[model samples]
Target chain A: MIVWLILGAAVMGFLRRVDLYDAFSEGAKEGLKSAVRIIPGLAAILTALRILQASGLMEALQRLLVPLAEALGLPGGAAPLLLIRPLSGSASLAVLEDILKRFGPDSVTGLAASAMMGSGETVLYTCAVYLSAAGIRRTRYVIPVSLAGWLAGCAVVGLFFR
Target chain B: MSAALFLMIVCGVIYAACTGRIAAVEQAVLEAGQEAARTAWRLAGGFAFFGGVIGILEKAGAVRGLVRMIRRPLRALFGRDTGQEALEAISLNLSANMLGLGNAATPMGMRAARLLSAEGGGQPSAALCLLLVINATSVQLMPTGVIALRSAAGSAMPAAILWPSLIASAASTGVGVLLCKLLERGGR
Candidate 1:
């Protein structure tokens, strides 16, 4: 990735007489601005995730969903993560950490969690925010398709595990 | 988001009170908030570094070449029916997501969303759905951050998850695009 990026920059810089330092600074500034834009939404999602988990609701939901997960052929341990992952990225990361710490990072369940986390997104969170940016409030056909893709990823993750 | 935010707070509070776990809930909320803030800080740093690199690439006009490279896949996945501006935005958006520059991807996505919504005449178009799904389930070329997490957890092969993740992401993106095409053909 670095090779390709730098090669592109080098070629383009030579041809375009680009000032690399100025461009770098400009992009860095945009990065900071984007970070600030996401903070409020991130804070709210993360805090809610904690409340759900601490209030015992998350656990109860886990127990309730475990059977469904097993019925769907996934390890029961991965059920909570599949549910939480759609809601918040940091929240899912938190769940992924707990799974790793509890099951050992090299274990099958841990591997499954890692694969799922690396593959999917904070679906509901992403859809909600992105659609809002377009000023389109109703997310018709978006959520279902997104979640379907997520489920396909989970199923494939199951397949790759020993 | 409004509904989700409302429900999360309401249900979290009521459920905690009902379960007599308000104390635990309070602590958890505080900790989660702090953790998320830390995550944001970490992401900001990552974004700053990569963003600078991208800045150089963009200013050098290399970004347009990169965008052109992915235009074929964008057309295939999004269909030829979508407009040029939206298609260009989707390609760049996917490229950012592929690099795991998600913080960068969001702002890029907003730009894409604006272009797409305008093209769709202020509604959710099938192409727009595809764009969102692709962004959400982007097949990672390098999951540097997740690999770092595995290393921190004392894994012997930190990069072991890389291939499995790619396979999973491929399956997800494949299914997402197929569904989008069908949804579009179904005339919704």
Candidate 2:
């Protein structure tokens, strides 16, 4: 799909008589600069996330949310996926797999987890990378608003898929 | 960002100490740093590739064409104060997201955010905040990854989540936009 998009872009550039190679390399250099610029922020955020995950704090938070999950008509086991969804994509994916394996894919918990994972984004990672790359210091309600969206998605998933 | 990170690390360390897992936490921080570097390296390749494509599009006036196509809706959402360049980049980011092209989405999003910031006189604009919220509550057309995983895990109906996920995604995006609108008004 992306390959097709690139090919189409090249064709479009060719028809426009643009210096496609020069344009590409110039843009690619900027891309590299921005990518490199994000490393420090990624390191900080990921290290903190890793600590949260490794020290079992993530699970502890999941445990605390289990009752809320159950109250929402989801299984207690689905709590981890919900708690971790905005934090880490890979972690939430792993939790989704764990839920599916334990509860069966067609089960209510499994379906809800799948839907929730499907709809949600890694809010922390996205905010950190984008804001840092943009060189913005103050986040200013981005996290709160994003997390509210995530919670809304999760609730919808629970209400419908479950 | 610092406050969030500080809280995470402090809470994590305290929790680890209470559970006698401080050694594991130390290991995790070291490993995470390396992992982050590795992740960044992988992202560099994708960004370069997509950036090149986007460059071609920009030079060919394709991006401008796209911006024109979505100009009204985007203007309505982001307001008239935003520049065309930011709107173009934002559209790219959003289309990639809807297509579930995460690797493509991030670079475009960063570009859009940067452009928005510049347009807002270096402060984070309402448009930028809206973009962030929308990205964080991505409206994917299909949860292809999850469906694939479900099928691999031997599910009877792996595609069952397709509509449900889309509905949930739309709901979140709607709510996010509403919240941003309300918050922008309140903040003003």
Candidate 3:
């Protein structure tokens, strides 16, 4: 991928008769601007998650999900990932690593991981990132639809894999 | 590392505020802003390039032509004509979803929604519902992000998840669309 990206940059530079360094810097600058606009949203989400974690909200949620976990054939430990899965991929991955370590690969934890691997994070985040970037605010049904799809994915994994 | 970096910044801010080190807090905010800006610019170019590719593909008639080819199968599965707008959106959405480019899928999905809305005379039609269902339960073929994570975690066969992922995604999408249609009818 690195090689392809480099080659692409090189090709663009060559075609445009621009220096590689200059072109790369230009692209980077544009990317930076896009990143800035999303900071407030990302910071707010992270802060809320941090507060939730600090207040043991996550622990309570995990405890509540334990029975469901067993019925769904997922590990109780997988609860954290299931909870975080809708919020952030990176954080969910950290939780996934914890599950994999505790339960080992090829277990139910592993299967759940496989399911998440094929799925996505919350629709709000996707909507926030893209819609905000595109400057659109009124997306009526996207959130509900995406959430339903995500829930369906989880259900399929739990029921079928069980 | 990213988490640690974030923690360090938060801690630094608190410490600085406590110590009345206004300069330190100011510097931290500036650095964070700079870092975020850099990330966004890179992301935008990528998104723009992806959106542009779809735009170019549409202009070249490739998108429409491909839509025609797949329309029958799509209609059979979706149980509706899906119109040109929905078809185009579905194609774009499917292509992006298969690539595991969730970020890239957003603009296309919105565009599809807008087109569908216009076509429906400002009402949310069944075709629009189908598009929403499909977008929500998109079938992924590559699962690139997962594969990358697996590789990073030292998986010998990062791509081994491909077939299983595809099967699972396909099944979910099928069931999801069916349920959406069923529920819509029941609601009526």
Candidate 1 residue lDDT tens string, A1-162: 666766766677768888878888887887666655556666777777778878888878877878766665567787887788777776678888888889878888778878878888887767765676677766667777888888888888887764
The regions of model 1 sitting more than 4 angstroms off are: A1-11, A25-29, B1-3, B22-52, B79-85
The per-residue C-alpha lDDT of model 3 at residue A107 equals: 62
What tens digits encode model 2's per-residue C-alpha lDDT throughout B1-188?
77888999999999999999999999998899899889889889987887788788889998888888889999999989888778888988988899988877888889888888875555578888899899988778978899998998889999998887888889888999999999898863
User: lDDT (CA) for every model shown?
Assistant: 0.75, 0.85, 0.57
| Native interface contact recovery, all models | 0.69, 0.74, 0.11
Model 2 TM: 0.95
Best by TM-score: 2
Query: Evaluated with DockQ, which candidate comes out highest?
Result: 2
Over 4 Å off, model 2: B119-123
Residue B134 displacement in candidate 3 (angstroms):
2.6
Per-residue lDDT of model 1, residues B48-92, tens digit only: 766677687777766677667877877777667767667655766
Q: Chain B, TM-score, each prediction?
A: 0.74, 0.94, 0.67
Over A134-162, each residue of candidate 2 has an lDDT whose tens digit, in order, gives 78877777888888887777777777765
lDDT tens digits by residue: candidate 3, A1-162 = 434534554554456465545444543443345445566545544544444444444556667977766665655655665566665656677776666556554565665675655664554455454444444444445455565666556665665445
Model 3 residue A34 CA deviation (Å) reads 9.8
**Collision pairs in model 2:** none
